[model samples]
Target chain A: MLAKRIIPCLDIKDGRTVKGINFVDLKDAGDPVELAKAYAERGADELVFLDITATHEKRKTLLELVEKVAKVLTIPFTVGGGINSCEDVAQILKAGADKIAINSSAVRCPELITELANRFGSQCVVLAVDACETQEGWEVYLNGGRIPTGIKLFDWLKEAERRGAGEILFTSMNHDGTKNGFANEALAEISEMLNIPLIASGGAGNMHHFADVFTKGKADAALAASVFHYKEIEIPELKNYLKSEDIPVRL
Target chain B: MEKQNIVIIDYEAGNVQSVKYALERLGVNAEISNCEKTIRQADKVIFPGVGEAAWAMKKLKETGLDQLIPQLKQPVLGICLGMQLMCAHSEEGNTKGLGLFPVNTLKFPAEDKVPHMGWNQIRQLKGKLFEGIETESYAYFVHSYYVPLNEYATAETHYIKSFSASLQKDNFYACQFHPEKSGDIGQAILNNFIKL
Candidate 1:
């Protein structure tokens, strides 16, 4: 069976992991390599290192960080944030990243998806949609949930699939830090609507939330940050609960 | 210190980075090269792949590497899609393979998880890659299809039923799972490959 993936995202700033990762045995939890290794050992199916620091910094630093993490990790890792060109994808891939997630660049240049899929294959390219509820419906927000693209969530996902993105990492900006639960309704709707795998992101407060995302949301995977960073939820405990829930998870 | 001169065939497939990074981490010098001359002369060859089997094979053929690879004499390791392409034929895109192994590449039976993407255990280990890892230790996998267990089969794993987890034919060793992502067991496997 296709085991549901559990991913812990690490947001990188200035070449270091920010937002405090409180995994036991580490004094400072902000080191990207250390945090990544801990997550991998604890049964994270994959890891996403998103460069949140946007400046004149070259993608090299991120690649270097990826190399360091890949050294200790024995699982696929996806790198995102400010990936705008084929060269960026190539360099990241060369640095040991298994996949690349695109947001603003993909939305700005829809053809960029096709170009990447053509050059590097669709499975290597992931489309990330940051969304927030609106009067009309869920609106797509880019640039780390700051700018609204005025595109409907479902519509954008359909288009992303059409553009050849292998997977969709849909994040609910409204539920991002709420710790309430995932936006299940949105995720289920998109998962049913698209054939590509959907990775549910945002608002996971506990193990039950992860279970809810897979069972109710029908998400192929659930991604969280704060809950994992604060050590409020342990990945092994969550996986054990999910396993009892009949969700096939890697031990 | 002299580099090991590792060449990862750029058949335009995927997952080259993990292999390169894994090798470099093990202190075995590695570089990605697709040219026939460079690949043939390299100390070792690592063929890493991700993507459709047929399309990947097509790209290799277009680059004329489809013919050159079977002729190499050095140790060559294939990962994921690279392993699939070494089979006689693939059900994926209904394409022909390098015939390096006598097995057939096939899709998992209908309604049996389209992409078998996660950790699963292996049985009947009989290769350099499984040097120190205990039996049934899980390895990360991410493919919808697999190679049927046969004479060349070195290890087997079951998702729905038994299937080849690893295959070895002379100088060629292929793994359906991604050793680059399988944690310590994976690192041990890669280390074994490096020492080979």
Candidate 2:
């Protein structure tokens, strides 16, 4: 059986982790490499480093961080944020990232998805879609959910799958940071529509939320940040909870 | 014990760096080479790949590795696409494989997810490759096609159906999962392969 994955997403800025991480054993919470190592050791199925760096030399720092993380971390990790072109992806992969997630760049030019899938194979290309529920229905958002694209969520997801996206990382902006729950209704629909794996992001506050995302939302994986960073929900304990709930988790 | 010469066959099929780093963590420095002589001379060779099958086959043929791999007497372990290519054929791109494993790789039926990705358990362990690893232990997997259970299978995993998680035939061993990226169980698998 394929176990439902538990992922901890970290925000990176200028080569260091940006958000406040509350791991007491961590010597340097800002260090992405150390945080990643700790997460892997503590039973994180995978890690996602979303580089929020906005400097001209951001790429260099990100590449270096990826190299360092790849050297020590044994589990798979994905690097996202500001990845615009194939060249950018090549450098990240060369730096040893198992996968690369592209959002705005993919929306800017849908052809980038096909080109990336062609060059690097679909397994490594993750299409992260930021969506919000509006009166017009689920509409896609860009620039970190500040701008609306006028594209319906389902329509765009169908197009992305056709364009060779290996997996879909759908983050419901309406539910993001709310600690309420995942957009299970929308997620179940998307999971049914696509053949690739769907990773449910946003609105994971507790261990039960993870269970809901996997069972109700039908997500292949669940990704959360603050809940994991602040020790609000420990991964091993969460996995144990999931196991008790009859959810297949990698323990 | 004398230092062992290990080579990771690199044909630009996939991320060989992860494999190299995994070995480095185990204190085994492996050389990444596509050279026939380098691969042939190593005490152990790691064939790691992730990509389309026909294209990978073309690259292997271009580098003359298609001919050199089967002839090597030293232990050779293939990962993911490397394992798929070791089979008789693959439905992907209608690729004919190295014929080392007497089986064909077929795409997962449309009823299930095309790419059977994520952590899955492997059971029915048989060979030294899984030594000290418990049955039903999980390993990370990412692939569209799979080698059905066959005589050479040393381990099996179930997704949509039962498939070869690991296969062994004489000196050659292969795994459909990325043991290099499978965390502790993965590292242990690699360590076992190194010891072999």
The sequence of per-residue lDDT tens digits that candidate 1 reaches over residues A1-251 is: 44789999988877877653222122234788988888988888899888876554656677778778766677888999888999989888877788899999988998999999878777778899899998889999878887898988888889888878878999998888778899999998998888677899988888899999999999988998878877999999999999999987877
Best by DockQ: 2
lDDT of 2 by residue, A16-131 (tens): 67653221122224678888999999999999998866455777888989999999999999999998999999999999999999999999899999999999999999999999
Q: Model-by-model lDDT, in order?
A: 0.83, 0.91
lDDT of 1 by residue, B56-94 (tens): 988998989889989888888999999999889999899
Error of 2 at B143 (Å): 0.6
Q: What shift in Å separates residue B43 of candidate 2 from its native position after superposition?
A: 0.8
Model 1 clash count equals 4
lDDT of 2 by residue, B45-142 (tens): 99999889999999999989999998989999999999999999999999999999989999998878879999999999998999999999999999
Measured by lDDT, the strongest candidate is 2
DockQ of each: 0.43, 0.91
Model 1 — TM-score against the truth?
0.86
